[model samples]
Target: MLDAPEVEELTPPVRTLMGPGPSDVHPRVLRAMGTPLVGHLDPTFIDLMDEVQELLRYAFQTENQWTIPISGTGSAAMEAAFANLVEPGDTVLVPTNGYFGYRMASMAERAGGSVVTVDAPWGKPLDPADVQDAFDTHQPDVFGFVHAETSTGVRQPNVSDLTAIAHAHDAFVIADTVTSLGGVELRVDAWDIDVAYSGGQKCLSCPPGASPLTLSDRAMDRVLSRENPVRSWYLDLSQLEGYWGDDRSYHHTAPITNVYALREALRLVAEEGIEARWNRHRRVAQSLVDGLADIGLERYADEEYWLPSLNTVSVPDHVDDGQIIDRLLNEYDLEIAGGLGDLAGDVFRIGCMGHSARPANVQYLLAALDDTLEIETPKTQ
Candidate 1:
């Protein structure tokens, strides 16, 4: 027999999350997570599940009956969208502007798709003309784009136009709304998006576990009628339909605690109204942007395509991005991030999402950022 290793009680540092994701979860959401877990298919749990789905519909501004929460994190929901939609030998088009577009390409490839790109520069939104051109050239069967590119802090505009272009080519459209849902203006039905997926931790202000995913009837039909079996049995939406669909049977154990937390978060959304939530995020983020400007920081993304939830600011010539980031976390218990991929080390990624989108949080972040910069600036000779 072996003795068990002793470990200390868990006590993590309390951080004011203002990074790209897993933003400050609402207090109500945290309280919900502490509630006792019921069986995934318990009678009470089933009813709660229905409530969650309905609330999700309101959040996405869609009437799709197929909306439900995925059992895992946001990426799981993202994979479910790709794995079920892209069949072997299908040509899928994805954007090349930011990191998540590459993620879409990878997921599609894993689903046996021949991926093509609709090109745009980092920190820029995709042009509808480029999407049209790609469709004309490649005739892809599926098209995917990030509604809000978290890496570059660029929100894609003219979504309806992009969807129209894909529709004209008879291509299915998938949107990555991981950073935009609830905090940004997104309309699934009005925009004619065939499928959309998002994370709970972003604009939802819920801890990451259960994620939101919805597919239009047309998208669901394609998924159900796929020629080959989906590569990922775990993420296969067809199998998942048994649980999330009307039958409400068992597929796998749902993340009950996360579901509870998400329910509370969506309740908050309903209470606030989605449009009002979007306005709040924009208003609060604008304050952050203006304060950064006042402190001599330049915005990395253009104003026309700026993502209000995640603001990217250009790093000063002599300032070390990592040093400032570390100081903010160590000294102030605030969390912001550096850029990813093409924009790495060139930008600071500050998030104003969900509960973190309050004016107080913005003011605190701006003040802390200003002090960090002042103290960390390279001394003049």
Candidate 2:
């Protein structure tokens, strides 16, 4: 017989989340999660499901009737988009500008796609001309791009132009909106994006579990007509349709608590109005940027393509970024991140997202960063 092991009660530090994601969840959302859970298919829960789908449509700015929360984190939603859309032996085009694009390539390849790249350096948005050239060169069946890249802090400009280029080649378009959905300006239908996916923790201020994914009717058509079964049975949208669609059937138990949290988060979005929310993010992020500049920190991404939700700043010469990051967390209980992949150790990735995108939080972050730098950086002679 084994004795019961002792475990401590759950008490995490109160942190100001200013990192890549899992941003400060809204208090309302946290409260929602605590509400009693009902059966996934109960009558009231079914109604809530309808409301969540409608709210997601508003968030994605689309009326495709295919918008629903995937049953896992944001990456699960991302995989759903790729797995259903890319048929075996199909040529898929993805960008080479940031970390998420590489993730897209890996997912597509797993789905049996021959991946091709349209190159752009880190911290830069892809040029439309380069996209057009890649399409002409590869003649891909599907094209994917990151709308607001978390890794590089660059928002791809000329979205309509890129979509047009893909459409001209009869290629479907997929957008990674993980960092932009509610905080940044994104128009799915207006931009002619065929499919788009986002996480709840980014701009929505909800804890990560259920993720948002939407597809145009045209995109759904391709998914329905795929010659082979989707590699991932768990992420197959066609199978998921029975539950999220009118049938309202079983498709694995939905994440009931996460769904509740997401409902409250999207309710907040509807209350604020999407455009006004975008403006707030921009305004708050601008203050963060100006304060960073005043403190002699240089922005790593260009202003024209800057992602307000995720800001990247250059790390000072000869300073260990980890030391500063550690000081901020230990001394101030604030959270930020180091860059990924190509920009690693060279920049700091600070998130101004969701409930964390407040003037007070930004001011606090700036003050903490200033104090840390003053102490850590070597003094001039």
Candidate 3:
């Protein structure tokens, strides 16, 4: 017989999360997760599910009846949107500006769609003129772009203009709002975004199991009439509809605790008002920006396209980015991140999201940063 291993009681560090995602969960949401779970189709749970969908719509600023939390993280919601919308032989236009845009292209290809690019440099938002040009050239059936790119800390500006271009070309629109939903200025209906998806862990300040997704009637119509079935069976929206839609039927065993947590998180959003929460993120993130500037760290993206939820700043030429990041966690229990893809080793990504978007967290982060770099805080900062 194998010997029993010595395992200790579970105890994780209480570190402040200021990374790209999985932001600090709100206390109420954490408490909600501890509540007892019921069957996915239980009457009370079904009622809670309806409440969640309504709250999601409110947060998305859309009247889309198809809004619901996907069974997994933000990526799952993203895949579902693409898999259902892009059928075999369809031409899908995707941005080349950030990481998630590449993910969109991959998903589209997997769904048997051909992918084309709308080009923009990393750390910059797509220019409408360029997007219109791409549409004129490719005449794609669908266009996908990242609303707020966590990898580059850039928020796509002129959303309405971009959507207008796609609509003029008779193409459907899909948006990756993982870092912007509930924490940035986004209006799905006003902007005419046909499909949008987000994660619970970023601006929602909840855990990662459940994600938010929404589809307009037009978008759903495309999905329902797709020439080929969606590639992901678990994520097939038609199958998922039976559960999240009015039927409230069996599909998969929902992540009960994560759904409870997401409900509480969206409740916080409704209580705060979406616009107020966006402003709060900006206010707190501005303080972080000021401190970074005072410390000679420049923001990677310009102010007009800056993402308040995720801040990317240049690493000083002389500083070893990895050492400082490690020291901050070891000495101060703080968590920030290095940049990804093209910006790797060139920038530091710090998040000011949902529960983490508070003056206390920003001030503490600034102080910890100062100590780690062996630099004194600026008097003005």
Candidate 4:
């Protein structure tokens, strides 16, 4: 066996995640993940799945019957939403403000749909008039956009306005709530979001495998009426519903550990109450903004479009973005990410998600950032 390549036992150093995702998992969730593994179809496990669905509904603040966790990560949930909803030759309008928006456009194209893009600068919200103009120009079969533009820390305000515009044009809406669901204010039912999906890692304070998704009756009707079969067998929501819904049939084996972690995370959300959790995120985010300003850093997005859960800071002209971030990782062992696409290296993304939103964690990041920046700048006096 070639001596098994001289394998050595390894232990991972503890990390404080202050980046885009996989935020620090709570102790309760970690304990839950260690529970004995049970067969996916076992009655007990099925019961837990039902509870998971219910908890997801609560977390999403929606009574939609189709709420369930997709087995893969958040991206899989995003694919499933578009695949099931967009038919071949259908025109789908997508907003181009950040990285995920482009991913949405690509997925729609793969589904054989024609795409029309409504765009804004990276750090701004999609203008309702622009979406209206697209509706007038394309007359799309469906429309979608990101609730929180994670790449630039911009949250679309008055989201219901977009929904109204789409509805007026008789089109369905797919809302990407991956980074906003638990950390920001999202109302699937009240906002009339037809299909919405979110990840467990960011603000849910769970491991990264589980993603929560919900579809309204109108979206489900479109899926049932589609002439062509869903492009993905694994991601086929109609078939997956039998397993995730009433029949509770066997499909793929669920990620038992991830499911356990999600259950505890959702429980924590419910226990804290949704509104209270939103308030906590907002308060911590304000403190983070203040701290960044104190260290002479500037936020990228305007205050009107800023997302409380994730903040994008503009790097000073003389400061080398990568060097400072590297120092933080090597010296303080904190994790933060640089920007994406057009804005890369011009900004730094610091996430104040879930458990990482605690004041102490924010304070640690603030102090480390101040010290790192001071050391990196040359002494003049």
Please give, for residues 226-302, the per-residue lDDT of candidate 1 as tens digits. 88999998888888889988888898999999999999999999999999999999999999999999999989989
lDDT string for model 3 (56-118, tens) is 999999999999999999999999899999999999999998888899999999999999998
Pairs of colliding residues, candidate 2: none
What lDDT would each prediction earn against the true structure? Answer: 0.95, 0.95, 0.92, 0.91
Model 2, runs deviating above 4 Å = 1-3, 377-381
lDDT of model 4 at position 300? 90
User: Could you give candidate 2's per-residue lDDT for residues 121-224 as a string of tens digits?
Assistant: 98899999999999999999999999999999999999999999999999999999999999999999999999999999999999999999999999998998
Error of 4 at 44 (Å): 0.8
Off by over 4 Å in 1: 379-381
Q: After superposition, how far is residue 327 of candidate 3 from its true place, in Å?
A: 0.7
RMSD of 4: 2.1
Q: For residue 134, what is the lDDT in candidate 1?
A: 97
Summing lDDT over every window of 10 consecutive residues in candidate 4, give the lowest-scoring window. Answer: 372-381
Which TM-score value belongs to model 1? 0.98
Model 3 CA lDDT for position 299: 91
For model 4, what is the alpha-carbon lDDT of residue 207?
92
